[model samples]
Target: MTASVLDCISLSYQPLWGKARSLTGLALFVQPLAEPPVPGPIDARALLETIGETLPADGPPLFVVPQSKALLLDTLAAVEPPPAPGAPGPRFATRGAATPTVVVPSFLLQDDSLVATGVRLGRDRGLKLVWQGSADAPPADDIRDGFHRYWLDLPPPWAAAALKDATRKAAVGQQIGPGRLPPGHIYGGIESRVLMEYCLDRCKALALAGWPGEDVVYSLRHQAMQPSHAVVMATLKAVESDRSAETVERILSEDPLLVYRFLVYANSPALGLRNPIESVRHGMMMLGIETIRTWLGQQVPYASREPALRPVNAQLVLRARLMDRLLDAGIEEALRREVSLCGLFSGLDLLLNEPLGVLLPRLRLSRRVQDATIMRTGPYGPSLEVALALESSDPSGVQALCAAHEMEPGRVNRALLDVLSEVDPDGPTI
Candidate 1:
């Protein structure tokens, strides 16, 4: 698609959390240029194709929830599943590998036209239909059997109170009756940790549709963030093969905690280095490839085995990469790399368990990086802010941020898509 199409739309992703807080997939939200730009009701098939190109072949399943009937039909028709493994074709095409899931709101099932023939088409095409509804409403019996899984919304506060005030009210804890919300349906719109836990732990919900932003888990800030052993091993491999410092540094960026630890180790008095090692590239150079390899080896066992944290680090890395991309191409590579770090460490306080004001000082990072991460100022600050706004899929917020900085929204969009499109998952392509 042309750049104009991309400019007319904005994309935001919400991670889906499954068992053990593992990231199961992403909910791709597409907003068609509204003023403030909340994810719009219906997205075009072109938008899906555009997004599909960016996702890795092996990335987690993607769920698209369309808010309009025509759009839903068009969306389903736009993609064809991969012709089995050995079929005649490229291994993976964006449309074929889009994998067949379209989250249909419960209300949509009421359409007489849909139940009549649409259900048949879904089955014929190998589509996986998922039902989305609230605690008080569900699909009618006629269309209920078509969906593979259901996405149920918890009872609203008023509804719970109303149910409690009824003559034959649901007793405490029975407000979400199986009759309305069958067990095993994924919980949708999980905005907080409490809701996420109740659905995954207390209720029998199979998975969650959205993450409770990290702010909700502020208490976990002090808990040590774990680095994926897989990533650590990758860094070690790169170093052992005598890859350029840039290559090793890119691998290190995949896991911020590992990068932090590396910087800390490089700065240790044991090294007796004359200079500070603030960035991963700098650390690799000062510490030497052999020293880095030995250190990474020692870290393999200490790495985290939890499946959940992989996406956490991946998302952070993407933001940093986007920040770097948003800068003018003419800018020197060193400044660009430094700005990327500003985005990378922006949230280190949460992972590192100390305020950046205090934590960043110990690392002795450059003033610009510190200012952007801590004070949210400096030349790097605008790009970081824009990157964050883009995450929300609020086109207006992104536009405003760009305008304020005299940056172009088109460039921001290009930068974001470029970073996201290039994602290479740690696991095999699905």
Candidate 2:
């Protein structure tokens, strides 16, 4: 496709967790990059087909269509099944055989006709429906039980807090009635509320049991697993300032591991090194300050001695790479570097079991970087938000963040895919 045409289509996937926090499903999203300067009805079917073609062969099965393209579901429903081999049949009837679940905004449920049509289509094709609701207008009673209702508007952190509050209430309810509480009493009469609360507590307890805690975080950052403090601090200082090669080398030589890793990375196949890196100075001369800084930033996670932190480190690198790639071309090189730092440090709190407010100051990060990473309030904030939103299963949240930043969802999706491909070439589609 031409650049202009390619720019029109953007696709990304969100992971859905099952009861055990296992990845049970994948929700695919195709968002239009343009905001339609001139408002008009979009060609939903054509767009859907285009999106389907762009997806990887082993990409997610569930596809989320924006409410603006509600007609796409209708189009799928109208498709006829193929005839028997011996019978004369329409050539196009065999298409639309895939019965991937179609998730739409809950507001669409307000339309009875659309809901009825969707139900009929779902039943006919063995498809499923998921309604994503906003805080202002959740799913209605009549349709709530029939489909999945994912609450949006609130970010993942806020949603988690709300769930914790609910879990607490449910614990109290459990104390009121030890035995099996009556059904239909949940959130209704006093008895029902108590029973419902108890059930909620039980569910929350079961879920939390499988989750990792501060101990895991602490273990990952154990003294043995920690990187060379002097080398790390020196590298940070070198990257923050326009230090000379002699300064950079002196700092790197303080730690043998730092020197070894830098040499290995500088000569790695990915860098396509023409000659072997003889020393830190040689690598610095061959790769420039910015490249070296980025390389050092990525090394932080890999430096961990704990094998379990490999996945976490990979995720941080992926986020940093994706954020760097998604940055607008107009962004200054320095700001881009800061944005990359923000992405790398975004998860440090979970990694080190320490708040960013404490960690960032220790690193002497610039005020802008500190604000973006800790407070999520700086020029790079939107980029970080976009990165986090890309990891979310909520399409509404992703769309809202993209819109707010005037970012093209397609571009963000493309950047994410590129980063994943580079980071984990053999891994499954994310």
Candidate 3:
């Protein structure tokens, strides 16, 4: 079969988490590396036939967003409702044959003709139509019965919060129940545990499109490691067992908090170092395995036992690895490792409760890494930007960055997937 347009494109994604941070689906953004020279819109055939091929059959549902109306219509046309039970179908079809959820941009709602056609296609084909707009964004003046069937986007940012807050106040006044959600609302970009609880527990939203891990980790600030420090304890054992610097760094860096602490301790006045520690490798060498072992021993008793911390730390480390993958592989091993550190420490600001400029400069990172991480400039800036773009999982943002940097989108997407596929010694990938 001829390759679909997906072959020349880079796809960025956000794993949509439902209540309790459960994996609901993966939202894949389509970005074309090279624009079509022909006078036509992009194709959506590949979204079904090509892009979906890259994902696991049994994995979460795939949410594919296309840039053009033609592609949107085409996608709706391509997917047919599942066959009736006992009907003829491919062998193992039920095992890994998850169809993608087609996302129709809010702009499409503006055109009555297009919206009508899209709704018809969706209903006829039995495709899941997710309207990417406010929960109330369906046409108000000329409401169509079919519009109600479309899955709504997360309520406009703050819209839900505003309503929820108002309801809370009203409930306090009249003693009414708190939930005000329209049944079956789909929320995205949720970043709060409080809001998550309201939506999931009270309003009972169908699914949420965000992760509250960062807030969970932030609440853990100034707290010692909990009992979940088993991983940390194991790494300390590695150091005690005379493990190589490489092995220890690999084990220790798995915990973002530990990595940050190591750098802080290594650069502390107690160490009396004129120059700052550059990498985990350097920190381990300067401090010596014995001292490092002893420091870790002190931490294990109080290390974080929070399970939520695992995924957060995993994501930070993966972002770092993705940045390293974005770098030219033929580059010197040392420089490559330095670039990876920039990625690793990209989240340092979140961990340390201080801006990266304040935290990183004290460590005396190389000017290039400093520029890339803090200033988003110099040689390594592009990789860091791309890494962030992927993290944000915005297709247009990824497209804009790739175009600005003259970087290939396909290569960047591949790099992200590659890093995500890597095996983590400490635990599961996020």
Best model number under TM-score: 3
Compose the digit string of candidate 1's lDDT tens values, residues 1-430.
Answer: 3345456554555556666665566665444444423344343556566666666656667777654466566666665544566766332245444463677766656755754357557757766678777866777676666678887776677335433333244668776443223457787655555555556655556777655546444535555566778788878888888787777777778777787788888888888999888677777767777787788889987787655454466667778888888888899877887898887788777666679898777785789999999988987888888877766523557656766887755566667767755655433110
- The residue ranges of model 1 lying beyond 4 angstroms of the native Cα positions read 1-3, 20-23, 35-43, 66-96, 104-127, 131-133, 139-148, 155-184, 189-206, 212-226, 241-244, 297-302, 306-308, 393-410, 425-430
Worst 10 residues of 1 by lDDT: 158-167
Question: Considering only N, C-alpha and C atoms within 3 Å, which residue pairs clash in candidate 3?
Answer: 225-302, 225-303, 225-304, 226-303, 226-304, 226-305, 228-305
Please write out the lDDT profile of model 3 over residues 1-430, one tens digit for every residue.
4444544566776656555444556667665545633335556554455444454555666676765566666767676555567875321233344566677767766765876577666766555566676666565444344433344555565555544664464434575455665546567666666666666666667666646777776667777434238567878788878877787777777766677677878989988978778778888778887788788888876776665555556666767888888887688877887888788788777766779888777775689988999989999999988888886645778778988998866667767655543433325224
Ranking by TM-score: 3, 1, 2
TM-score, prediction 1: 0.73
Lowest summed lDDT across 10 adjacent residues in model 2 is found at 182-191
lDDT of each: 0.66, 0.52, 0.66
Tens digits of lDDT, candidate 2, 41-145:
444554444443444433334345554444545534633333445866422212332334566655555666676566555545544455555534656655555
Off by over 4 Å in 3: 1-10, 31-34, 37-43, 47-49, 79-97, 112-115, 139-178, 182-185, 212-254, 266-277, 281-295, 305-315, 420-429
> C-alpha displacement of 146 in model 1, angstroms?
6.0
Q: For model 2, what is the error of residue 351's alpha carbon versus the real structure, in angstroms, after optimal superposition?
A: 3.2
TM-score of each: 0.73, 0.49, 0.75
RMSD to the hidden true structure, all candidates: 6.6, 12.0, 5.3
